[model samples]
Target: MPTQILKEQLAISIRMLERANHIDFNGHMSTRVPETDFILINSAAVSRSTITADDVIMIDLEGNVIEGNGRPPNELPLHTQIYKRRKDVQSIAHTHPRWSTMFTIANIPLRPVVMQGAVLGEIPVFPKSQSISQQEIAEDLAEKLAGHHIILLKAHGAVVTGTTIEEAFVRSVFLEENAYRQYMASQLEYAHSLEDEDIQKTKNVVWQPNNIRKIWDYHFSKL
Candidate 1:
């Protein structure tokens, strides 16, 4: 198979993870393989800062091994379910960014008032349940993710997906930043929260999955 496209995508995925500083012993990045039900995901336990294109592992929809030497993420089903449910999606990013994690612990719905927050809008909280497993998390996210690109999982972390790695990466970074700001704003005597109308307008203007593709392509071209 022609690997030029795959290689480029992998490099972009790695760079996105690195730039966001999302690396840890557990955090990971993954992208869908073109024209197939496979995903190229970073191997488990790899440092996000040092991840190279060759460090990516290709896995089937069922989390079955395909190629590459290292272990695929235990959350493989998370990416696969999204690909199965949303054909338009080309990539998925899962991270443990600090601020987003704060919201996860606080059990709050992140509101959008600032431009970046507006770009993200509202993020729903996922309640943990015995029935909720990794395989079913994507479907749960899809239900609540109708107009949002980011979600805060209760006690888990933040999950964001996009048509390209860059889009996903940007959303992830902004989501965490917004969460941090919101927390700080709450403590101040007076902080401006977004009005309902403004939030709705942003949701209307930039929340579509297709818009993510357009934005990323423009950025990718520039880079």
Candidate 2:
């Protein structure tokens, strides 16, 4: 089982995503326990709107529930395979942000336009729209997402990974913001992506500890 702090953090993030409008009903988040093969994930059956620390379940890399109540999300592989492939990733969030899905559905490349979006880097789209339930499909998508921060599932949702739960939560929020801005800009004809030099410079401040905490604290304050 995860510590009380970990459970609280996961529960808070679920509420954070919900408050940001990043997820409604079919969303999930998970964190890898440090120095172990264990993971703490939110229950799929638990309503994100009313999630509590007790709703978090512990599962190993193989998806077996080690503690807590309720089942992990059906898209467990969406999280497990990635944790296996990316040693750098400590947390993951699966969300169905409207604008981010629009980019995938319309085949429009979602580029970094806002300063905070520079942290997202180049996002790839998984070829399929169906639920990522099978191990094989999850493994393939993991390979496709191995070197990226986020991947959009065609006509579905997005999977976001971060070095910390805070980063993942913020990136998920920014993904939708940047996408909506790009969409609105495209209507006029000039939706220029952030220049490479600009992206390089902006990322330095965007990922700063204080800034990240500011975002996390802001959301936590709301709830």
TM-scores for every predicted model: 0.78, 0.97
Candidate 2 structure quality by residue, lDDT tens digits, 1-223: 3477888899999998998888998899999888889999999899898899999999999999999998999999989999999999999999989999998888989989888778888899998999999999999999999789999999999999999888899888788889999999999997889999899789987888899889899889999
Best by the TM-score measure: 2
As a TM-score, model 2 comes out at: 0.97
Across 1-223, the per-residue lDDT of candidate 1 in tens digits comes to: 3454664566565555555555456666777777777788888756665666677778898888789778887776667776777777777777767777776677666766466687775677767622233666667766765656666667767678777766777687668667778888878854476787787787567666686666555544644
> Model 2: how far is 203 from its true place, Å?
0.6
Global local distance difference test of model 2: 0.91
Worst lDDT 10-window in candidate 1: 128-137
The alpha-carbon lDDT assigned to residue 189 of candidate 1 equals 53
Which candidate comes out best when scored by lDDT? Answer: 2
lDDT of each: 0.68, 0.91
The Cα RMSD in angstroms, rounded to one decimal, for candidate 2 relative to the true structure is: 1.3
